[model samples]
Target: MEFGLWEKYYIEILDDFGFSREGDEESAKLLDEILSTEGCLTLNDLGEIVGFSDKYIVFGAGPSIKEHISMLKENYDLKDYVLVAADGATTAMIEQKIVPDIVATDLDGNIDDILLANLRGANIVIHAHGDNIERIASLTSFFNNVLGTTQAQPIGTLYNFGGFTDGDRAIFLAVALGASEITLAGMDFGDIVTKYSRPNISNALEEADDFKKKKLRYAEKFTNWVAENENVEIINLKE
Candidate 1:
């Protein structure tokens, strides 16, 4: 998506979360410099990998991810579609021995699982934001290859795929890559947050705090907007 088009939502997100636009820009600059070093995948490289696939399934961290994938596995041949996992959803997919083609994360999820997937040949789509500057510094060095992105602005090799939460952002990435058909899985946007969504919770379900719920709502809204504006077909497994 164009920076001009995505700017409004970026500003709204900043206001909603009381986040810093300058801080986001700084983080993006950090990530851009890091990814521009030498061997990291450029935006074109990411597009090349994702561009070949016509259909995509983006897995969110909602509770039903495992079950949904399991059911799909039994009925359909998943090789036809590109698989993208959103942050902590990597754990669920890894546990099921399903290595996704791409994993989009802000580095807040289980680092070990994310690295393990990277080692096992998954392309990491790493995002930079206000809070994760140190994370982008310390952790990005471990990855062999990464597709860097930012919500703020495009700088160097960084891109603005145009969504907020990891789940919606993954969808945006797919859209940017020319996916004609996109399927949503384990993307419940309701009030209850699962352990997979929250990352390593002892309890199965937890009540989402106001901010968390609001983010989910925005995720849903953005997906809908993209579906309409981009004219991509949406297969909502949630419904």
Candidate 2:
């Protein structure tokens, strides 16, 4: 979608969902800073990192992630592939000593590990939102000064949860990074796993069910968007 259209859609969705659009604005600013930073990697740089011009693997924190890590490791080499980890997956990946090429997070839940990864020479890509603009700005400064420059500079992707689903930023950023093939793992958008903890609400299970349904719907929309806008391929590891 065009930038203007996307922005309008995002505002409408936020109003409908009772979510604040401030976070989206903050995300946009963060992205702007990253893109304008000196010696920083831009979307074009990301495209080159993955080779093939564009291809990526998005790792979600769903229970199914554990099952496919080995398969992904055995089948795909990380030499020139972008690995986008969602939220808390950074911790799990760290435990396995599997450093993601790029980590995406919204400064929620256990953000320290991401900082640690940056210290250890891992490229971090923080997600920015309007509500957390100050925090995101702080992080950008910290990385720029403390992390020390390397061949691979850390990045920040601004996300406006405007008209998109919760995790759609992960998919969109992966594509923006020039991923021609985007594979998904640990995206339990169907709630097919029984061993996982659902987010807490008055009706947690019911909420999870609804969240799963919405995720699936978003995934379908994402697939269609990719097919029409870019020649990117969407592969669902759950199937």
Candidate 3:
């Protein structure tokens, strides 16, 4: 999709989900600065990566993720595809010792883990927003001079949470990365399972419901936009 049209839909989605346009604008500006300074490419860069992959998987730190991990390990070929990890899942990925091909996060939680991953030579995709622009910018030098040579490239993306606690930035990052058939795992937008140890477990169900409602609405709008612009297929990993 054209960046301009996608930006419009992004604004509309945020508005529908109770986000402020002013905040989004600020976030966009910060993202632009981060991308420009980091020498990152657009979704076009993702196209080059995607063209080489047969399939792609997006890993969310949802409760159900624990259950699917074993299956994913056995069924999927790790080398041929890209594994995109959301912010919260970085620690979990470490616990499970799953080396993600790429990591996306806003640095809200699990900073230690992110740092650890970078230290271990894992390619990290830092998430950025206006609120955290200064912090993200501060890390630019470290990521560029120190961590850049470790992985393929450190990336950053514009985040639009859609005002839903469950609307993970990882989803958009995966799409922007040009996944041909993006399968989501641990995207349970309902109750949190007892098996999961995330802090939001108590309110998982309520949060998931709210997130699902907003996600459904956004998907409908995003689907229409995609139909008119690009030929990308979006699928729920749980399904």
TM-scores for all candidates: the values are 0.96, 0.70, 0.66
- Please give the RMSD of candidate 3 to the true structure: 6.2
Q: Over the stretch 1-239, how does candidate 3's per-residue lDDT look in tens digits?
A: 33444566555655666656565355446555656666663445444544567366666766777767777778877667677666566666777887665666555546667677767655655544434556665564454212111011122444332222222444545555565666677766544432232444566433345654565455445434443444456556576
Clashes of 3: 2
User: After superposing candidate 2, which stretches have Cα over 4 Å from the reference?
Assistant: 26-40, 48-53, 144-166, 191-220, 227-229
Q: What is the overall TM-score of model 3 with all chains considered together? A: 0.66
Per-candidate count of clashing residue pairs (backbone under 3 Å): 0, 10, 2
Residue 54, candidate 1: C-alpha displacement in angstroms: 0.7
Query: Residue-wise lDDT of candidate 2 within 1-239, one digit each (tens)?
Result: 44555656455556655656555554555655654663355455555554553567777766677777778878878555677776566666676778776666655535677676667655655555555567666666544312111101123433232225324566777666556788887766654422222333344133346655655566556556665776688888887
lDDT of 3: 0.53
Q: List the residue pairs that clash in candidate 2.
A: 10-162, 10-163, 22-130, 23-130, 23-131, 54-178, 54-179, 54-180, 55-179, 55-180
lDDT of 3 at 130: 39
171, model 1: CA deviation in Å?
A: 0.4
For all the candidates, what are their Cα RMSDs to the real structure?
A: 1.3, 6.2, 6.2
Lowest-scoring 10 consecutive residues by lDDT in candidate 3? 145-154
**Angstrom error at residue 78, model 1:** 1.3
| Local accuracy by lDDT, each model | 0.88, 0.57, 0.53
